[model samples]
Target: MSPHAPVLLNEVLEALAPQAGDVIIDATFGAGGYTRAILKTGATVIALDRDPTVQPHADAVANDYPQTFRLIRTPFSGLAEAFAQSGEAKLDGVVFDIGVSSMQLDQAERGFSFMRDGPLDMRMSDEGVTAADIVNAWDHGPMAHIFKLYGDERQSGRVATAILRRRVERPFERTLDLAEVVEKALGGRRGAPIHPATRVFQALRIAVNDELGELRAGLEAAEATLAPGGRLAVVTFHSLEDRIVKAFLTERTGNAPGGSRHAPTAVETRKPSFTLTFKGAREAGEAETVGNPRARSAKLRAAVRTDAAPWGRIAA
Candidate 1:
């Protein structure tokens, strides 16, 4: 295995517990790390990724696991369709390592990282709205909202204001240009551990990709596709992604409160389509975090499918 293994590899494998002949899906097949690891266990792996740049890595894995592995060039939200195309009635397991991958962040041309000087194009796939589109074209209110809601940036309004002020002179085209404007707006990092533009950039990427919506759809698709007793494991790198996973599992496992304080009498109970494999989310250990900084924010959540019918759109 490569030294730069996927985050929480052992834990995800343990949760899936793949055996020979088992069929699995690597929903976010970045660099084919998870898919390759699963295939080595003698299981058939179907990997999905929307990013065209991942094709080379997928090809390398395909050659290595010709009989047991395949790649589908679509977002994970389309995993159910991919499975349907596979003609596999029972999906034994599905694993997702969500959020931007290390490969995407490392490439300067990909324009995912604020640290790298590149075009302000953060589209995970070839098509769709780019980061430049969001930053340069979106109005101030929507832009500030995403900065606050997606990135959790405290000075979202201020940052958006700064971008609006600069774009009038010349449209923002490069990562450094936007980063510089954001940094200046936020008072230049203020001796912070992270760059001042980090949050704003994160907000832009998430908005450009509609990451939260995709995650919700993907989780629902996984629920509808997995066979009874099948397993699902998700690894998230930030709170926004982790929260969605946590909430989905909580509701699906029939563990969430039926009604809110204001709607105490309007309770709606549904059969649980899955059961939690663990009580709460799992974090990387001290040793793993030391070796991989990306693992620091990583959280693993696993569940087992039940015989109950999927709740579908009713599940939050």
Candidate 2:
């Protein structure tokens, strides 16, 4: 299997600013690329991944890093509880490389891509309900919503109707079969840069894994777990995920509406929970993008935690 390349490595390291003896969290430890790099800084790493496949990679790293590195086979969404149980007082930094990992897409059996034909099983955690279940069994309304919202496909209704109609005759099982149905519905784009079924497959994977919800929960957990002055760096591959990260940062820093009651609120008073480390979303450099095409859509956002409770009012 080809090795998984961590996107925007330089930027991640820069934003995270790793220091020796610091306890860090590698929230989405795919192939341990980021985890390994962080460990090289002499920082302790608590790696987490929902997929059990990553455990082997983590195990391998543990041999090299010894007690400096540990892996948790659970979603990053449950990070707070996991850290607490691990007896970690606080985190120095947390890194989240969101969206489907290259490892999963490259492995045909994982079925994250239309490029490779495999069983339509896109569940990040192998134990959960697979993409096949969502595609083959969901009602037309929810299926349509998935395509439209998650996939951002304009032809969601038609595509969902096609899948529903076709699956009635025979339940969808393979990646190619579902891709064929979507392609047929899309009428076979002659020279489109991307496959017609790309969006549909993305929608199915997102739905099956509850990726958006996981992202929200993970962000909340990260915020709660971060020590004052600790940094959190998130790299997102899609607009939907980026928006959530952007909103969360904005809200936590009190950069949103209702900042002040007087003086027009020129600057935030209550030291922002996370001072924006970068001016705006940082994209992968040309070299990185050329090396890994998947880095094309990647956006990295970083912030630091403040002493105040940023989510107190919002949560209530």
Candidate 3:
């Protein structure tokens, strides 16, 4: 497996500004990268991850930190419940590093990388629907929708048609086979630098994992759990993820566009739950990106919680 490195580490650390007595959450806890850094600052950390593969990593962090750290094997979307169950009333900071890790991508058996052949299992939690399950069973229309919406693939129709026709004869049980089918569907790469199956694989993974939905729920949970003046720093790897983060912060912070055409009820008007910590999203510095290519597309967006009630907490 490839060694994991947390993208935008400096940016995240700076945004959280951990203090000795502060309590923080490493919301994704993949490889315990951010948790390790936060622990270095003498803060207590409650880390969460849905992947059982990271349990050993979390155990190592707990061993290192002893009383100052704890790990919960759960999705970050369960942030509110996790905090409640931990008996921690509020949090000083929550840091979310969204998407797959280098460890997951490098391990062929995990099937996250199309570059290597493995079983067609792309599950982060090792639960829910697998990529093979979707590809082998989903109807062509819904399959095409996943490709077009999540992967932004223009050849979704052709690809979906190909997959349906091919799977009828023999279900795609391996990453390389599905990739080959996609490549053929798209006319064998046509000299594109990216693999022909890149987008298709991404779409399958996203659809199976319900990543966007998880993010939405997790953001809401963060709003509910953060203490007043607490920090939320999220690092997203793509435009879709970043757009959701930006919109969540924007609407929660009362900066949403005023709509005369479609205004929500006066009582349904949102109370500002957070304030932007910076002007807009920040990209990885040249030095960082040069060292870790994964940082190339990373974007960091942060906010400080206000005293106002969370969107769900407020009475309509």
Candidate 4:
């Protein structure tokens, strides 16, 4: 078997506990791996993905499961709206696999890889502003801010300075071009395990996609759509996303840390909308880590939806 297996597969199965006839949502149905597993448990799956390139996988699942599977061509952030559009009031389970998919990264044309040369496009839906647009057109200050905040790159200002200087000569139109410029700006990787352009690419991808914002919306959407006892499983590939998931689950599950003596607390608080499924996040097993290197960074945090009214909408 290939080591490119799905991350935290068995753990997700354990968390969701999908049963026959249950309606589950594979909120980020990248390769449809999780959806397929859900289908095997006799659960009906509503799989969503913004990337049209994933249509073939969707077609295959729909073909195999026919009446038991549905594919929605939309971002996972729209989970609640899609379910409402389907005339369904509640969901039994919802799983979100956050960050770029293997399908996207494996292809160079998507411009998600720093290792390969490709067009500088990184729009998952192919319908929005691209990474090329940002790198080539964005100002130095904004670009630096994005790299620092979103990518966690320490030398963000320096990189931005380099990008601005280079783009003045010729705007970056290729993935490798921008990567090389960044590498040069950072003074080369030397012996670093990863490429110097990794963080910059990640920041650009996140900014272009508004990933962190979308994650917040998706979490609330899941809260609104799930029925009592419904399961919500989120698998994040990086610290930024994992932090958001952890906080959301914590507050919704009524486990937020209490205020200290110096910080007084408010009198009113909304009832918890979920119950913690476990104490904390779950990591990939050693076997999984070896089988799928991508699983090494994967962290799963799940909760069971409570009967309490869902949280009100917030800015995405």
TM-score of each: 0.96, 0.94, 0.95, 0.95
lDDT of 3 by residue, 1-316 (tens): 3268999998999999998989999998888788888999999999989988988888788888998999888886788889888887669999999888889998899888899999999999978889999999999899999999999999999999999999989999999999999999999977899999999999998888889888888888999899999999999998989999998887778887766647675434757999999979999998998989999999999999999988863211
Q: lDDT (CA) for every model shown?
A: 0.89, 0.87, 0.89, 0.88
What candidate 3 gets wrong by more than 4 Å, as runs, is 261-268, 313-316
Per-residue lDDT of candidate 1, residues 78-145 (tens digit): 98999999987789999988889877887888788988999889989989888988888889999999
Candidate 1: Cα lDDT at 29 = 88
Which ten-residue region of model 4 has the weakest summed lDDT?
260-269
**Candidate 1, residue 211: how far the Cα is off, in Å:** 0.7
- Greater-lDDT candidate between 1 and 2: 1
* Count of clashing pairs, candidate 3: 0
Which stretches in model 2 have alpha-carbon errors above 4 Å? 258-271, 312-316
Q: What's the alpha carbon RMSD for model 2?
A: 2.6
Tell me how far candidate 1 lies from the true structure as C-alpha RMSD in angstroms.
2.1
Return the clash pairs for model 2, or none.
none
After best superposition, candidate 1 residue 37: deviation in angstroms?
1.2
Looking at candidate 3, the ten consecutive residues that score lowest on lDDT are 259-268
The global Cα lDDT (0 to 1) of model 4 is: 0.88
